[model samples]
Target: MLVTPVDNSEIVAALDAALDGGPAVLPLSADDPRAGELRVAMAPDEPTLPGTAVVVATSGSTGAPKGVELSAAALTASATATHARLGGQGQWLLTLPAHHIAGVQVIVRSLLAGTPPVLRGGQTFATAVASMTGPRRYTSLVPTQLLRLLDDPVGLEALCSLDAVLLGGAATPAPLLDGARAAGVRVSTTYGMSETAGGCVYDGKPLDGVRARLADGVIELSGPVLASGYRRDPGGTAAAFVDGWFRTTDLGLLAADGTLSVLGRADFMINTGGVKVAPAAVEAVLVAQPGVAEVCVVDLPDEEWGQLVAAAVVPVDPARPPSVAALRAAVRARLGGPATPKLVRFTDALPLQGPGKVNRKGVKDMLRGT
Candidate 1:
């Protein structure tokens, strides 16, 4: 949820009203007009769905909204484990949009801590931290959100005060992580989705009630925290989960220390000539370049290679667009042969869906008929 106020008082009033309904109310962004347009009429004798305290809709960057049913038991288990991991819950500075599971987790964790998270003004992350009512502060942010916060000195300073900062939603840039660590922020990169009740894996470690495994390079999650299953979408539910393990589209590796390192989504794999390549692996290297801020690698049809590996890049330095040859050389230097992108394209910004995830399909279309 993206909270926007036509009047400031209304926002406060809504929060107050929500709190009045329940001391543990999770206040979320109700600003999207489309959210208001959704209507659910109750029947006089309709029975409630079993085990559903809340049903959060998935971000649907890939497809349609998946109503993930979460029981109070599941949410409580997640929040309790999270609190224990962070040395008990403190005042949370809500940053991510409320509609997201990540944002929802903040409220749930705060409620479990017996204190509602404080809402900061929509201006900056630092301001949000400053607005919090007590000590032992925490916040969750996506990589893009974290990058925006880095732009402000005050925000960076405020971030350093947090006990732990959970970062998730997509793969984070290495440079950004380095910047956060350099600033003395307790950053924890997490990996999980709506099905696992937000981030069950924090900083590569699976939390209590969360289990992770890698079978043939694909990440499989099995735990009490996993959603009862994707709501009503049988085909999707069947395709994603098997034998109690949620077969994530994302690929991962289990280190000897038992930490999970998510590689990239298997769906994003591309075939160049006869070799299979993960575009995200290439994008990861591209983003590490001196001038590159963001990047997306996709496979396009080619007369010679069957599929030409191309990179859509957003350079941090506008004056210096990394040339095709330079990018190819960089790829060669970092990851050789099949992993290197052949074509490099400079873009103002990679097409993002809602948050900062690269829209691969959109990028593919953008490169089409060129």
Candidate 2:
């Protein structure tokens, strides 16, 4: 299908429709003549960048869209990296929506694997897995999708059939990954964003031709998969790529074994009495408590402490809000003095934006009556 820029959205929708057992119309854009092929427009006067494929979107968590100029080489580099990491691609099962880089990578990797993936149309994970027609199969899922799969035994068994499953999009709660691994699922955690044309790190290690490093606590990446800067935004491009490295806002540490362990975003760190505390760390501990279903830790303004650690949690049972004291005690057991949350407020359900991620700004506003 020759998909013009105007038909990009239609192609994405049609792709999903095809996967869901609906009509498979090869969506073509006004400018393009064929199906399944997309041709994005460029200003005739402006010099085209090195890449053929240009993805325009912000990293969803940050809420700012910038055009990422990518070359076919860069995208192919990412796909090749993924193929090498996954021991050559098996039959891929599509679950995520098209248009996103991760979803796009699935299609490309399937092509690179010399076999089109089995399109599991509009079905749940179990239904999707049951529909595949290959020996060794693989799929990609976000943390939330993985959690939903874990909620049922049948779903768990279905996931176990996959030779490998790439888990990305957001942090995978350790407990959730542990449960999946215990239940016989090969879950490999990945890290990357749209700027890198999807994930470059797989299972804490950078794929071949990918570079992962930390500078001043900010996670930085380089090598083949990095986008050729933002489109028509010199300032944004310059800021995103400095000295040939894309410095991510995420802070992380390189373990002794050379694995990168992300430590949440640097801006999200809460300072209490001049001590820095990681909200993700706090929430990770809180959510492990017996009665907690979900938790979001935010920094609340405090004249004395500058910013106090406050948490808004969703309990498993409304009538069983964990006591503030008990919650504090639980957090303290894992984290020392400054890491404990000063305030614990229970909510019916934590405000969510995008699957599995609690909307920090929205949660703060909900607390402030904004």
Off by over 4 Å in 1: 1-49
Model 1: lDDT to the true structure? 0.72
Write down the worst ten-residue block by lDDT for model 2.
34-43
Give the Cα lDDT of each candidate: 0.72, 0.73
Note the residue pairs that clash in candidate 1: 1-98, 1-99
lDDT of 1 by residue, 1-370 (tens): 1122223234334333333332122223466454432212111123323555545666566775565656566777887888888887787777766656777777667766766776555656666777776557788888877886787788788988888999988889889899899989899998888888788898899998788998888999988777665545567778887888888888988999999988888877878888988787788788887778878888898988888888888887778776767778888887778878877778787776644566777888877733
TM-scores of all predicted structures? 0.86, 0.83
Winning model by lDDT: 2
Winner by TM-score:
1
